[model samples]
Target: MIKNHLSQVFYCFIITIILVFNSCKDKINSENQTKTEQTEVSKTVYASSVIPFFDQWKLILGDGSNAGIATEFENKDFFYTQNDGKDNWVVFKSPNGGDTHGTSNNTRTELAQTKKWYPKTANDKLSATLKVMNVSATGDATVAASHSVVVGQIHSADAFENEPLKIFYKKYPGHTKGSVFWHYEINTAGDDNAKRWDYSSAVWGNDFSVVGSDVSTFPEEPKEGIELGEEFSYQVVVKDGIMNLTFTSPNHETKTFTKNLLLSEYTTKSDIPEQTKKLFFPIGQDGVERSEAYAGEGCFFKLGCYNQTNGKSPEVNKNWCSGAETHGGDIQKQYADGNYAEVWFKTGSISVSDTAVSNDGYFAKND
Candidate 1:
């Protein structure tokens, strides 16, 4: 009787073990099925669907891969579509030490317009509604380009290869809000790029000249500034060598700027702004722009996250170099430590016109 009882208990224990094993297996299968379903749902949204202009542009990811004609394409590591419950946005993410473009140390996951046109003869416009999501958190506070990203640009592809417009969003670490500024890189005379310098203009806060005293310290935050994740819109209209820029944000004052691309604003040494002299002259970058700035130059529009943070030593160029942590160029590690830049665009459009539209009352309406 004792043996039979022991046998029955052993068989019961085996049966219970098998039941528990089956239950755990079923749970694992269910979780995997749920994950598959979630992935299927996420695959429905594409970057091209968000902007609808992918066919007219070529994408260069931070990994240095050229995603040509990126329609119906998405890369979760760099370029992808993200939804914020209220709306869907196209996200451009780049690491600080990833692959970069020609001769540029900074990495970018951006869209370059395929068709190039001369600013003098062509009337083109590009507009976008975007917000900067993140910037490199580990960098010297004294560095001007330490925690910033370029969102929009009109890049010249000819004659000295300078940029006429670069919309930037910069925020120092420990600051509540960042500054919205634009830069105009001079087309240096005699094709000498080493002397090329950028003139910065602020739209909502301090310009690029604002910096901290030391590596870890930061300046006071801007009173009227745009915080991370705040929505803003920028419109760039290049009409016959004249560029008109408009920036608009909710609860903040709208700003408008007009520049003639055919004429040089910094033709002589005295034409340099005082801000440039104090900030850039120390770095030996006080070059003057050509008399005809970007005249008849082939240019195109670029929109996305052009990461300004780099791992270069700040001792070389304190203003441009951030000396940020790059983790030996490992992208995964850099991203984990906030050594990256991210920007998101909800809506964007590009149009070419034979006629120029009037921007009348642009400044007066804001005032």
Candidate 2:
């Protein structure tokens, strides 16, 4: 009987030891797995991580939702991050017909800088390395703004609220290459908005005035223009009321332009260019810029895909209206049909003039 009791006690002790050891081992393994998952999550990249300057800007999505502080924000349909096997990119997408800004008829998934400054008081600069991934594929080819997207701008915040600069990328359907251009809208002298016009200049290929002859007929493709998915960079620096622009791309010539904001280039009726007369005159847009162009007015920077395509009747304004197929503002249907614009930015920054920059930094600093 004594031997039997001793053997039973021993067996019980051994079983308890085994159970405790297994429990401890399972707990350790679970802890290690949790740590690994935490590390992976911490290393994940977001749109804010790609563009650190989001702290200084607010976002407006294509669905009309606005975000003030978007430190780690993204929407799969409008603004999000993408990895192209090489590196991650921040994408801005918008459909042709959807929610729009109160002051405009276009839809956008864009960032607007929160800080506004006067050109004479501050030297603000915005730079970016980007590519136009896609644009509205279906539109009236004769419309100049059709099938185009504005990637960057310096928008006014004062009277009339005109845009001082709008960098545009336009590609026609069935064309392999696209054109890069910029437009400077004049600050109209009077209250009528109908008289305002934009003066456009081309960085690569034809300017905004080069449109198709008719709705279906297309123009010759720009021989040296940029293609879809091609990378390019631009810098806009406003120093002492003078605007300086620089555009650079791989395998293309670098272009630079300068404009004086304190002085007016179009103070009289005859100061209009031939391109503007031919493009805007028939539409009764013949206004001239004020003497002190954009001076003392508060302005902010905007970056993203400001889709220019709309569903308006082209007969009303052939130059501005696109009359694209909208499918009654259905976003998913528009996306499936390639009736949207998408722009991807690899890197970008907005800085004041006095900001220090490393010599080998990606953003090109204008001395």
**Predicted candidate 1 versus true structure: per-residue lDDT over 1-367, tens digit per residue:** 9999999999999999999999999999999999999999877899898889987777888887777678999898999989999999999999988677766779899888776777788789899999899999888889899899999999876656689999999999888899999998889987577878888999998899898988898889999999999999999998888899999999999999999898998989999999889888898998988898888677888899999999999998878888998888899998888999999999999986644232222212211
In model 2, the runs with Cα more than 4 Å from the true position are: 1-44, 353-367
In candidate 1, where is summed lDDT lowest over 10 consecutive residues? Answer: 358-367
Global lDDT for candidate 1?
0.87
**TM-scores of the candidates in the order shown:** 0.86, 0.86
- TM-score of predicted model 1? 0.86
* RMSD of each candidate relative to the true structure: 7.6, 6.6
- Tell me which residue pairs clash in candidate 2: none
